[model samples]
Target: MYKVPKLNNQGTEGLEYLYIDSNGNIETSKDHSKLINDPDGVLGNTLKPLLKLPTSMPKDFGFITYNDQPPPDDKGVTPSVNSKFGHSKGLVMMDKTTGVWLLHSVPKFPFKRDNNFYPTSGAAKAQTFICVTFKYAEFQKIGQHLLDIAAFPFESHFPADFHDQLKKAAIIKWNNREPGEKIQDLESDAGTQFKSIAKKLYKGKMSACWLESEDLT
Candidate 1:
């Protein structure tokens, strides 16, 4: 099993859960109960102002989510397609300076863009995630990586002047595209350096090193 680092209020450089309180205060908390949880089986309509672009982002911003399983409508009818396409699930939100990419294993989540509710369906099982904060320039490579994986954006919004790769990623539809990979050395704003190997339909070795703490427990 992998060890998770201890979280604290001043800890912004390592693994930490971003929790927004009802008062719109963004804080890092180890208490799961303090985090928002939706016990009712319904999509929340409450708008999280804390997640607004002008509030959370330093400047102009945009976001997009790619998932194979579309959220069921109010009538409980799921949208269907003629062909089987991408199956990746993730969300990428960014601004002119920085961005957040959340890669998750949850399906039928994020039913709407206005709310920040965690679905009951996703809570049934332990979901895995790889959330990273990267500089705006790195998003260009990230957009290209999504295209290589043929991730279909079920929901997306971005400025016209933003990276062209991001626009292309928002409209991915075909699954017959050739497989590819893009390797890059990336450095976070916090000075953490790492290499990323994005692959599609290929077998390869995956490795990463986190030197933030000597003891990950």
Candidate 2:
């Protein structure tokens, strides 16, 4: 079994549950009710503004069980993946805008990748990845909202056509293609298009740690 990490809120420590299985998947659990009443107090008021939506009774929420076993001797040490906690059975919150009843269990992991990895040729053995269960309606709504925000900038400075182009450029970048590949595979004009729009919309206003700030910059 994996150990549960301590959660701190304004110098107070809260109870948390850890569910781990033999295959190396780990998840943290917390009471959804506590989170709803004290969302700002818990997350240091960081997510208060973004969580403007009203709290609702979670139709579905619980912990996911999974195996947490390390790879065999020949496989070597696998890099750690970050953990995220939430009220929903899945790590994702039901509503991105106003779901204060959810708690996130973010872990310090060495690798930066989605929590899905399958052992291939080099591994000594095979392992099964755990899929988190969630309510259909809640998942769809949150997923769509996030897609809209990530694909299209909410700012008014960029035109609709420019936003669409920027979304395409972002998709290209997400695929980890080289500049030349992006140009050939995606929009041939992607090169100057994203640059021009980005320069105009975010002139001297971008920061590496935007989430750390009190307000959107």
TM-score of each: 0.63, 0.19
Pairs that collide in candidate 1 are none
Winner by lDDT: 1
Model 1 residue 97 CA deviation (Å) reads 0.9
Model 2 residue runs over 4 Å out of place are 1-90, 93-102, 108-135, 145-217
How far residue 141's Cα lies from its native spot in candidate 1, in Å, is 0.4
Worst 10 residues of 2 by lDDT: 192-201
| Location of the lowest summed lDDT over 10 successive residues in candidate 1 | 40-49
Error of 1 at 170 (Å): 0.1
> Candidate 1 residues 1-217, lDDT tens each?
0112334554432322454432456544344323324322111212232245444443467777777776765677876632334567888888899887777776775664444445545544444555567899988888877777777677677888899888888875534443456777777656677775766563456687557877789
Q: Go through the candidates in order and give each one's C-alpha lDDT.
A: 0.60, 0.25
lDDT of 2 by residue, 1-217 (tens): 1222233443323223344543566554353322212333333232333332222223232111111122222244542312211111112322322222222222211011112121222122211212232333333333332232222111111122322332332241333322111111111111211110111112255566734657765
lDDT of 1 at 14: 31
